[model samples]
Target: MAVAWYRARLVESRPQTPTARTLVLRAPGWPGHLPGQHVDVRLTADDGYQAVRSYSLAAPTDGDRIELGVQSVPDGEVSPYLAEDLPAGAEVEVRGPLGNWFVWRPGGTDPVLLVAGGAGIVPLTAMVRARGEAGSPAPFHLLYSVRGPDSLWYRDHLAEDTPGLDVRIVYTRTAPPGTSRPPGRVTAADIPGVPAGRVYVCGPTDFVEAVDDLLIDLGRDPATIRTERFG
Candidate 1:
């Protein structure tokens, strides 16, 4: 399919965590998107210089607005612009809903295991939302790893609303003094008890690679696992 650019209006923007923010864009005439797809955002300056970044859509496919969960890197150019500079009602150029065969649609029969590191959970969150809304028979599980609670995206949503999905949050840095959750990266033991089915993973290149290796060591079918790496 051809890529189309839309002039989208920022409708809502809020901090999902101390380091990440969720931005909602409203583009009335923009074509809708599929789950697990991403969009390219272009930022321009008065000097005519521009930068672009690709971000996965966090909202469910059925939602009218596109949601992006952005985490700020130490000196990330585009992320800082999005997280700090951009404000609600700002117009932006977005070309999106693009990908090949990576979508997770509702009504599927197989159970889904999502492994995410840091902001990688964005796309999988959309899948979880879609399945929950459709009341699909398949089971959903999530293994999300972050430095700590401060960097965990969508922590409140997962805590309050994800009653139907199995979620395990792993923290790898200095945990709060009394935290009871696992205080290291995700391991094979962290995965929930479920039958072999589909596994989707996303994270930094090294993190994704390590998780893939862990899955293999756990006797999971390599062919059933899919991965997408960023950074």
Candidate 2:
């Protein structure tokens, strides 16, 4: 649950979307992190002001280096620095590849359903990456929702054809030309075929709650679903 804060250097900062960046960080002795784990990043100002924020790990568990996806919040304190201002070699205070309740490990052939909205795709992507690294044939499905094409993260990566995985996208506000579906919220119809076991949902608090309700209405037992939410 707790780990010592250490200095992590930003080795690479890759843009996932217009508003989000994935910072690849390497620590001297990275203890490694499980899929869906997160780390706290701390920033200090020249005037001695400090801001701390938690960012989800965006990469697989196979490496000493990890990626943290940061979506800049409007008028926020930390993300702006992380997404834009922070240099590649900048040092950051980081703590824990934290959280246990939301993790996905490499085992079992049960189907995995991952529902994500906006930046919530971060941790779930980690799970997908972990599954790929382990070469598990488990069926993994991702149902992702966003306002428009611009809001979608990991655009190129998502378009890639990963084996044993299926991704469905729902556009809430706008879609490309010749789309029949209206811009609206995701319903049970947006997702088809419930996984045989536990389903994971991550997104804004409201999105998580609504999806949870919808899943239940679709006859999924509430106890078998796990959720991690961000504001």
Candidate 3:
């Protein structure tokens, strides 16, 4: 059976970085989604041409509201519109609350580790928010890698010293003044020494593969790791 596409109206939009935007949409009758799921957004042009793209859910639903984090892809058909041009009250067709394997549910007592690269942080951010919303006692550690400070997302919230959550940021190209780690790709040193009960890795294909290998080398059980990757 085909998943139904519902009309979603843009409620608000906020900038995460110069090229990334967070969109809040009000989709009436939207079934709530898991933290790591995504939705497909369909845009129709005046000439009857349509384009669709999938975006990670930035947070769990709030009643009829759902959120997505979009990083603009230069010269792309879909992302540029979502990241820069879409305006409030504009209606688009949305399909999902999709994917199950990547999801993180609330009841576990063990620590959770999250690894995100660039826009991959979108879904992981949702997991973090869900953890807080559910009041789950699971400790979470987030290791996020980006090109530089200018590209970071959820800056304000991540900067906070939230109890039971540890947030680490890695800059691949430029580092802020006095940052201990030099600007470079994430290395084994960036990964936690302690093993987490459940590990989630999301990022570019290369980044995810590198992190998975590093985790395996550090004696983390392959069975305990879950990964989601994108270009």
Candidate 4:
């Protein structure tokens, strides 16, 4: 079946960091998407030049609306605009609800282990919100890795004490004052040993691969881990 493109209007835009932002789009007639699916956003210039990029959905679809979190690539074409200058009411074409293996459906009590590196938090955020929306009793533990405190996304929301969800932030570049964890990459110690249920890992290629290796070393079944690597 062919997935048709829908013209979506930007409903809101909010910055997550100096180089990243979250976008809310209202696409009429949108087929609601599952958590962790992504969409291709098409942007056209006045001269007929078109650029497309895939962004993970940041939240579960809400009626005619959807959300995405974009991290600007230093010299990329589409991200800078979406992350910095795109305005509300501007229209763009969206095609998808893409990728099946990475999705987390509602209504499961199995524990979920989410490992995110940098902007990889986007889709995992959707899973977290989906769990809440569906009233799922799934236990969730998120291990998020970032450069430092300033680059962390969902700072306030993750800080909130939510039942059944545990979040740990690992700073690779700079650790906050008086913290016991040192500034370094994710070590075996950062990952839980042998996740009993599904384990989702998303990040840059290197980060995902490293975490996947660590998970395997920790006695986790490799088949139980699903990874999505970007960049």
Candidate 5:
């Protein structure tokens, strides 16, 4: 079957952080996707100019709706519109549910370790939501590095208990009040006691590369890790 572009209607939108928003889109007849999949969204301007960007699904596949977390990039062609301007009931052209290497399914029993930097949490959050929705018993750990507590997306959702989910946050620029960890970049020492498992890391190109090298130096097999860079 030939691939096709589909129309996605914005059903809901909410703040994920000060600079980002999560949009829930309704697409009928949409085939479901595995966690970590992304969609290419296309927007057309009044003068016929168009821009396209790929955003990962942030929630577990339910049936007809999918959630996307978009961060507004300064002077960006597409991100600013999606993150801060798009309104509910508007329609956007989308293609995909693309990618395979970075996806996770409920069948795996290995411990799931997720590492995120900034907006990269989009896909990792999907895996977290998937694990809970499927009632999968696999142990899950997330080491999320962000600028500060205020920049974190899905802060409330992440804080909610979903059995077997463990999270540790690292502050890069500033830490919250009464915090024990000083604001600093995530180093090799910040990793939780996660056993050898399927590790997924997502972030900017440089961040992903550094984490990949760090994981390798820590004695992790390169083959066991999957990564996606989205800067």
Candidate 6:
């Protein structure tokens, strides 16, 4: 598919978690996108040097605004700009809704297991929202691993009161005070006991690889696993 550039204006920007922010943009003529699609944003410096970065849309596919959840990476190029500098009404150029096979819609009959590490939850969150809104028949499960409770994105939205979803949180770095589990990384043991049909994993390269290995060991079919690796 051809990529088209949209001159989008920031409509709203707010923190979703301690380290991440959700940016909502309005592109007047922007063609709507799929749940797992991403957009490449370009920013120029004062000297005319430019940096480009890709961010997944966090909002459901049918929303009027496009939302992105960006985690602030220390000294990272585009993240710091979007987190600290970009503001409402700022004009930015972006291209896409790209990628073909990775997109996830809500209509499937098979169960879905979504595993996300750190800010990798962005795209999967969109899938969850879409499925919930559509009253999809597919059962959904989420395994979201973060550094600590403070860094867990969509904390409010993932509560048990939310319908049609099963969510589990794994705090790798710091667990709540008085918790028994050691404060560390997510291990194969942390995975919940759920029958896997289709699984989607997203996170840093090492994280995704580790989870993929664990899923394989747990008897999940390798062909049924889909992954997206970030730096």
All candidates' lDDT scores? 0.83, 0.89, 0.92, 0.92, 0.89, 0.84
Per-residue lDDT of 1-231 in model 3, one digit per residue for the tens? 678799999999999999999999999999798899999999999999999999999997688899999989988999999888898899999999789999999888789999999999999999999998888889999999999999999998798778899999999999999999999998899987655598999988999999999999988999999999987
**lDDT by residue for model 4 (67-135), tens:** 999998888899988888888889999998899999999988999999999999999999999998888
Which portions of model 3 show Cα errors greater than 4 Å?
Answer: none
lDDT of 2 by residue, 122-151 (tens): 999999888988999889989999998889
Please say which candidate is ahead in TM-score: 1 or 3.
3
User: By TM-score, is 1 or 4 better?
Assistant: 4
Residue-level error in angstroms, candidate 6, position 113:
0.4
Error (Å) of candidate 2 at residue 11 is 0.9
Give the worst 10-residue stretch by lDDT in candidate 2: 58-67
Candidate 5: tens digits of C-alpha lDDT, residues 1-231 = 555678999999999888899999998878889999998999988999988888999987878788998998999988888888888899998887789889998888899889999999999999998898888889999999999888998888699987899998999999999889899988999987688899999999988999889898899989989999976
Best-to-worst ranking by TM-score: 4, 3, 5, 2, 6, 1
Error of 4 at 123 (Å): 0.2
Candidate 4: worst-modelled 10 consecutive residues by lDDT = 187-196
- Each prediction's TM-score against the native? 0.92, 0.96, 0.97, 0.98, 0.96, 0.93
Off by over 4 Å in 6: 178-180
lDDT of 6 at 184: 77
Supply candidate 1's per-residue lDDT for 10: 93
Q: What TM-score, to 2 decimals, does candidate 4 have?
A: 0.98
Question: Judged by TM-score relative to the true structure, which candidate is superior, 2 or 4?
Answer: 4
CA deviation > 4 Å runs, candidate 2: none
Candidate 1 deviant stretches above 4 angstroms:
62-64, 161-163, 176-182
Pairs with backbone N, CA or C atoms under 3 Å apart (clashes), candidate 3: none
- In model 5, state the lDDT of residue 86: 87
